[model samples]
Target: MKKRKVSVLGSTGSIGRQTLDVLSAFKEDFEVVGLAAGSNVQLLIEQIKEHKPRFVSVKDTELAQELKSTLSDHSIEIFCNDVGLEFISSSACDIVVNGLVGSMGLKPTISALSHGKRVAFANKETLVVAGGLIKNLLKRNKGEIIPLDSEHVAIHQCISGARESEIKRIILTASGGPFRTWKEQDIQKATKEEALKHPTWVMGPKITIDSATLMNKGLEIIEAMVLFELPVGKIDVFIHPQSIVHSAVEFVDGNIIAQLGATDMRLPVQYSLFYPQRRELPFNLFCDLLSVGKLEFEAPDFNKFPCLKLAYHAAKEGKSYPIVLNAANEIAVDMFLKEEIKFGDIPKIISSTMENHKPSEPSSLDEITELDARIRREVSERAKTSKI
Candidate 1:
């Protein structure tokens, strides 16, 4: 078998690290051709040493300089900043695993697709903010997309051969985060520590906070629209505390098919890398349904998690509001992590940002990024005076 060439953006993050782990196990099946990371030069150096990718992208000039100084006998080419990431994305590869976080991930996906390479998309921000743009790109581009997130992967698996028109709705299962059972009043005062204790699925800090607020599931809702081209109304989010059923798709015929698995991200990661082909993984990695015993499902309470309601509104409002939603949420999550805001303030801040935003279609990537920056700045200013 010819080794599939792979490039990993955001090589230092949670998804990137897990992807490397999966790749290491299947060395005979794939080749790590390029790597990129944001400001984690030390970790990037270590990954470069192990994977020995032909190209590596560092966050900035200083980090790039540091990585160069750390280089030991590796004949690898290093690139820096955003353009460097674009270079890595467009480089020769079979698949580009865009594990990058935030709006920055969008460009790399576009770059990879323009170069006719398939994308294993894990970044929800890319779709949430630029779903329409991505749809236009796909119509003209040669590349294909395979979702890396568990929920989308589950839906993708269930809808593998099913016609799009036959689908009634797609149901996304949420673990309900760490605050699932916490009282509404208690949730307001929840600490970062309490929020990070995800009942299932280990993820990065931003996403974990989002999960805690149910905003991550909300973001996934918009992302589903981009990936599946389904209307927001046709999408449903169900609170599934077990985390076993990742997601489900209901057909017009009233048949509901779901993909159930353990809370392991590697399952989706491997699925993205090797789609339509299931690789052999250890039996222990498989889900134990008997041990799980029972799975429970409930409708998400918008009153408890207003961020979710905001996400749905943003998706429906559609123009630049989704951009505002993402930017505001990112800032809010950062503020929460920094102890500058209370748990409840996450949605409040996002709401304020969205309410103030004048929706406009982004004409270009620069506009998209500028809109994100503008919203972040406005949100940061609002957070200082926000009564959280």
Candidate 2:
């Protein structure tokens, strides 16, 4: 069988690294063609040497030069900055595994889709920020998006052969992060170290903080609305501490089809990489139900985690509101990560930003990106002054 050529964006991130692991495990099934990363040039260099991708990109010219000097292979092409990301996304590859974290993933996604490549999408921000634009791109281009998020991947698998009309509701499960049991007052003063302690899955600081604030799950709700083409009313989130059941879909007939798996992200990564063609792994990654005791599910506390509530409102509003919400959340999360703001301030920032914005549909990628940057700047300024 011929190997599927793959390019990994954000090659040094948590998702990007795991994607490479999946490729390493099934080397015979896929070929690495390109890689793009931010400031982690050392990890990118190691990945380049191991995966031997023909093209690679970095955060800036200095890092690109640094990477170039370290590489023994003179034939490998290197690029840098946003231009580099766009170039890598449009490179000759069958699939672009987008593991980029924030709104930065949007343009690269558009580039990949425009070039008719399949996207094993791990970046929820792309969809949350510009879902209509992405859907339009899919309609006009040959590109497709197979989600790599655990919850979305579960929904994808569950609804694979089912008709649209047969679906009643899509159920997304959350691990409720590290502060699931914390009181409101304690959670308000959560330290950076405390927020980063995810209960089930280990991830980047931005997402881990988002998880603690329940904003990550909130973003996923918007992501689900876009990816599945469902209304906000059709999607429901449950706080499942175990995270054994990734997500489920309840049929119109009251039958619920759910996808259960281990806490391992590789399960979803591998699933998205070779979608519509499930390959058996040589190693053990399956979940054992016997060893795991009872699974529990509870409704998310809207008052406790207002970020989730804000996301739902944004999804329902459905214009540029999601864009503002995402941009604000990203900036707020960054502030929390840097200890520039308290954990409780994340939702406050997002809420104020949304409140100040006038909702309108963005017609193009340029407009979406411009709005995103503007919101980020405004939110950053407001957060610093404690104005939100």
Candidate 3:
């Protein structure tokens, strides 16, 4: 049998790096055909030396030129700008692992799916931004997407081989971030370092912050709605501090099925890459009953984590609201990380952006992109004048 050809976008981020770790462990089962990243040339250089993918993309010309000069001995195709991502994703690889951050991932996912390639998606924002678009492309090209997030992947597994009608509701488990038990008043003064401290899983800065704000879980709720074709009302979230049970499903007959695993992302990544088949790995053994005695679940405090409520609103409102919410959250998270906004201001900024905007029917990817740009610009402008 031929090895599966794989292309990994955002090759230097947390998900991308862990994805490479899995591929490295199962190198004989997969081949690296392409890679893409932002401005992390030094690490990209190292990945190039190790994986030696035939194609790679960088953020811009300077990084691309630097990468090319570093690998002068190898005849490789390199690209910069959005076109680079397009070219890499459109390649004839067997699968594309889109681990990119934010709306930039929207196009690569479309390109790969449009070309009929299997896509293992870690880029939840792509679906949040353009779920309808991706669904249409999936129909046109006969491609399928596998979920790479732990929560969604767990839900996917529980729902697998079962009739969708049997499902009562799916429960998405959250780690409650680093501030799960923080005092209500303290969250307003939370610092960048504090928010970045995820309680369970190690992740990139953006998602780490998102997790703290519960926006990550909120975004996951929207992604689940799109991926499972389930109504938003049937989806719910709970605060699970241990991160042991990633997600669960309740049957109409009063039975509950769940997928339990450690916090390592490699499990989900590998599971998505090789669906319906479980491979052997040495890491992340099942949780010990003695060490992991009891599990706890709590309702998310909407007042403290209003970004989550905003996400639910966006998901329910439909149209361009979800797009605006996602774009605004991305910008607001960036600003908050830079100390331009207070911790509590993330929801405020996103809410303000959504309220000031008019939703549209963006049938085309170009429209989505244009709308994303407009929302980001508006969010930044609002931030400049925001009295936080």
The TM-score between candidate 3 and the true structure equals 0.97
Q: Tell me the tens digit of each residue's lDDT in model 1 across 150-190.
A: 99999999987776799999999998988888788999899
Estimated TM-score per prediction? 0.97, 0.98, 0.97
RMSD of each: 1.4, 1.0, 1.3
Best first by TM-score, ranked: 2, 3, 1
Clashing pairs in 3: none
Which one is best on TM-score?
Answer: 2
lDDT of 2 by residue, 84-172 (tens): 99999999899999999999999899999999999999999999999999999988865999999999999998987776788899999
Cα lDDT of model 3 by residue, 1-388, tens digit: 5899999999999999999999988888999989999999989888988998999999999988888888864678999989999899988698999999998999888889888888999999999999999988776756789999999999998887666688899999999999889887899789999998898999999999999999999899899998998989999999999999999999999989998987889999899888878888756656665687888999999988889999999999999999999999999999988898889888888888888888788879889999999989888886787632
Candidate 2 pairs with clashing backbones: none
- Candidates in order have lDDT scores of 0.90, 0.91, 0.90
Better of 1 and 2 by TM-score: 2
Q: Which of the two, 2 or 3, has more TM-score?
A: 2
Model 2 is weakest, by summed lDDT over 10 consecutive residues, at 379-388
Model 2 earns a TM-score of: 0.98
Model 3 lDDT-worst window of ten: 281-290
Best by lDDT: 2
